[model samples]
Target: MPELNGILVHPDCRHFRGDIPCRPNKENGYLCADCPVYAPVQERILLIKLGAIGDVIRTTPLLRRLRREYPAAKITWLTLTPAILPADAVDEILKLDLASTLHLQAREFDLLFNLDKDKEACALHDTIRAKQKFGYTLHPEYGVAWPGNDLANHKFLTGVFDQLSLQNQKPYPQEIFELCGYEFQGEEYVFDTHQDKGYSWNALPIGKPRVGLNTGCGDRWTTRLWSDEKWISLIEQLQQAGYAPVLLGGAAEDERNLRLNAATGATYLGHFPLEQFINLLYQMDVIVTQVTMAMHISIALQKPTVLMNNIFNAYEFDLYGRGQIVQPDRQCVCFYRGTCKLGTSCMEDLPADKVFRAVQASVNA
Candidate 1:
């Protein structure tokens, strides 16, 4: 039994390899007592958030509360998309690989929070050693992820039709804080840079309010997508109003960006690396996009955003009052489906003029 960073490095220590903390600075006599690399962990905490990308980013508000509650605790996070989590936010980031999964199951934690509702994450939560467990856990007989507390039930209910219809007014972060015995204090997302690219922007036109159009919503929920013609019309409106319309998207939207750029003469700043893209996003005066990761990013950056939402409930998002959610006049019959069964999609009913007005309002606000 050796001490690493003031915490006993037992066999259950996730940082321990054999009898010592893994990668300990040998200059500190290998006891990890004086090691600068590893801090003397006062508490062991684990957070599990796997991806749909946007959800992982949105969950970042919890980090501020966690750090506030356990100031000196050693925080370790498990995520599929580690890039989204800030480097300074957690002591260690473990990707959902075989080794990390096995290590987590073997380790003991002072506090553990598994917010994911996935079966695999919930199953692992049941096995991990922890003094206190918050968020979702595995159900014994059904083998599905179940809420650990009453507050968490609110979040669970929103997933199904019946519970969601109840129209819970609580914001996501507020409900998430209830599971951990805390209150949300308007904490923002901690999107730390992966690397400072120091990239310069000469493409953007000068002396005009930059309006970014995040074109792609990824492949998951096709119902969230707006028509290209609608986007073109919006671009034209922005240009007529003397606002610079910039097209933003990932590699998946390359062809689309080119087409939109050619059609509307908007600046198409093609897909950039994540960090560079973030830097670019910072330059925007207002970002107009579908309910995608870009919307979360815009909100995280504190930029005024106009989010075009159709399928997902608008109430679920907590934008900190920095953004506006524009919904179609007609109710969306397709909730979470990939395709719109109706001949006229709900998103089409959302005219370009309506979205342009939202952009104008967001920019002015």
Candidate 2:
């Protein structure tokens, strides 16, 4: 503890920041000695989950369980996409960078969970000072990522071998929870919906249930991409069935989305920044998307979703009872392959009619 004007400062207070004035002191001009909201930090917990934005977003459920388990703990999360994380759930959100890495190395934690298998992430986990560690760490001798404990072995094994991953039935949230020695009970994702930002989509059609069609699966996973014909068919069917079909994607799908909009007369509001994109997604009643970031966002929004799958294991996703998984009628042999092994993708076998039926069921539900 330090003293300012002969008044002892509570350094371990949750709101105390050594570098600058704390929020209470800045806003209300309250000194630490007489601050009414001085809550002591019981434990320091660090969570390291680095990018592939969707993964970062999905990992938010752990915060809920952590808050319940360590009510007075100061939780710090290190992630590449810090903007997506719910601010209210975390005490500190640090972007994964050189400065953050240095800061973390100098800090000690009561509990540390490194949920990423990346070499840097594991290396940090190995070097960091923590009383209890979970998830993965670097193998000091082998210089490779390894499970921190027995609980993480399942997730580690699944990641290394596609066959093991396909056989595993545990959803991602459950695996992460188990890694940290906790049982997951359908905890919802903690997301910043950006509702307070006052973003609106006035052009979005009204009256009918808005069904968002997320058209892109990113450049890496081309196997997850359904044919443009299927998308057009689904859009036409939705329009015929008296539903508003909205096309959603980022820059990659801009040209294709425009083509689709021109051909089918579906509404394409064009891509937006992350927060505004989330707000746009917030308007959808039901969303039809591949296992991309949009799928995670839709699930976080608690909107009914029809997830189209081909490459990844369906068991890996927990839709939180808000959606259903519609895989191709023909089993995809590619497993997690980025490109289709067969000249024709199994996604071709997944009929537009099947997807439409799933969307219809979701909307009606």
Candidate 3:
């Protein structure tokens, strides 16, 4: 066999937890003896993250990797507001809300990871007791319990695990599969009623290859959109090519989604539940969106997606992959804050022809 090099350490050379003396350190430039994550095997785990439906969805893969590495461990997630709740690995969701008494009630966990930037998240993480505590390495003023708000100048999935171990961490991740052992089977996320509103997915139809369309982007970033005529022209082409387009958005998009659906006679499903919306997306042929979380969902599901962004640089692709970026590639306009400097003219420039070919090829592929 080839050289299988390793190291030996003193019994006193333990980590912060003084329990997990070491595992073969595969991160940074250091060995296990130098690592700070020295907790022994944990029985329960917790992960906290908030906002942006797409980001929450994309983070799902971390759970899968964790489960594969450690099966049979009980895992939980700490979530905020309306994020894509991971049903597969998480045994529970620690809701960060006004009515939640978890932190105040002195809930003890083996480990809890927070992955948000807001200061309130830091306070809660510090209070939650565990054998080992860790979070995204942030400023000292934030007052978290452990080491690492570790994500920094990283790309794509790197922003999750390795970045959390290196760069600037906002908080620790909330993935439940980090424990060493378990057997679980379920969908990526489960959509259910929100606080007894009597909502259900039973009424809506579940179709194959579900495709979601983020027709309305934030008003400030109008330069990132494809024009009305361009959208209509492209959807028409999709219909002609034997695919149906399902228009999606939030309550803020009612007027636009309604008008566009009327104008082109497309299927308009606006401002639905994020989980229900994701269920619909999982049933589509493709998702065509702006630089929104919906696009992230498509990436998480490994579904074909087309993102209409303003640029083709590595940064934009970091948020939205190049494979799903809109046609013609680069944007002539530079305005990206609240509204386009050149009005909606930048979006108007992209004709349906360019996107149509890409759509057909992806659909066929």
Candidate 4:
């Protein structure tokens, strides 16, 4: 890491304007570390974290921590196109569209944090050229080494993140407590961006302690998913039991979402903007999702959540939090495959009544 005026500027860092030549002199354009701007960067921070909805939800706590870490900075988030719709945590949401954004000039940002490990995402961080960059080192051992689909991969990532916090002198649980500085607001957050795939503003939360649900299935991947029929059955039970259901997912998941909505007479705000989805989730009492991101979002929301995971491959830390987990009665038979040899008999083993009881217990509790 090369230092300029106390700022660590890795020579690999890309910050200068292509044709506009400016000397790398510390006096004129000093580095991030030594500059007066670093501490104030939380106010003008840029974050690029894109993946499943749960991942985005999980990252919200980082924003809270960052704000507490740097109280005076503005936070501008770079969000995936439609995902940018309703993010209440972000001060401003920038679309990742290269065509439109390429014409826009880069501005001076105090820090850039890339939560996702996508190369394209890394490139975006390189472009912003924030005074500071925080992310997985892109190291081979940066996370768990996975030869096959396994829950340990998620566990490994959690461990890697913990180690990263320690390496940075930032502890884990305390960091979480510090970031979750604000008390949980009962209001549901909503979307601001209106791109096609983006969520609509009309999508709002209903009921106090509102709960969000991601009841979708997985086919291409080995990650577990509860059957739609099971989730629908649970939803109907909740409806008769006086609970309003809120379904969230991308537009592609809307068909499944509609199926759930039609069956239960609950609210089906089709895949709104990503921001909107999260904002709406904030108002939920809890979120119950398949093994994917449901529980992840709940953790971020500081609300209780329940996720159904394949017992063998669940992320340990996530399962430890305000989220409760239910798993297959048996070890994963199919593991990671195009299809399960047992026709996913292992997952089918979780009777809906047991899940319904769990839901009732959660809702009442």
Q: Write the per-residue lDDT of candidate 3 for residues 1-365, one digit (tens) a residue.
A: 12226553433222212244233343443444455543333366666666455556555545665555555445667666434564434655667676554543366766665655456666666666767655543446745322343222232234335323343332212222222122223214333223344444453334433345677776655556666677788777766766667788778778878888898777875677666666666666777877776776666665677766663232333322224455444364453344556555455666676666666656666
- Provide the lowest-lDDT 10-residue window in model 3: 171-180
TM-score per prediction, in order, is 0.88, 0.98, 0.64, 0.56
List per-prediction Cα lDDT, in the order shown: 0.81, 0.92, 0.55, 0.55
The runs of at least 3 residues in candidate 1 whose Cα sits more than 4 Å from the true structure, single-residue gaps closed, are 1-39, 162-166, 193-195
- Colliding pairs, model 1: 5-40
Highest TM-score among the candidates is held by which one? 2
Tell me the lDDT of candidate 1.
0.81
RMSD of each: 3.6, 1.0, 13.3, 10.6
Query: In model 1, what is the error at residue 347, expressed in angstroms?
Result: 1.2
Clashes in each model (backbone N, CA, C under 3 Å)?
A: 1, 0, 39, 22
Tell me how far candidate 4 lies from the true structure as C-alpha RMSD in angstroms. 10.6
Q: Which regions of candidate 4 fall more than 4 Å away from where they truly are?
A: 1-44, 82-88, 99-108, 126-128, 136-214, 218-223, 228-287, 292-303, 311-313, 316-323, 333-338
Per the 3 Å backbone cut-off, how many clashing residue pairs does candidate 3 have? 39
Model 1 lDDT per residue over 30-79, tens place: 54344444545578999988867778888889889888877778789999
Q: What is the lDDT of residue 302 in candidate 3?
A: 58
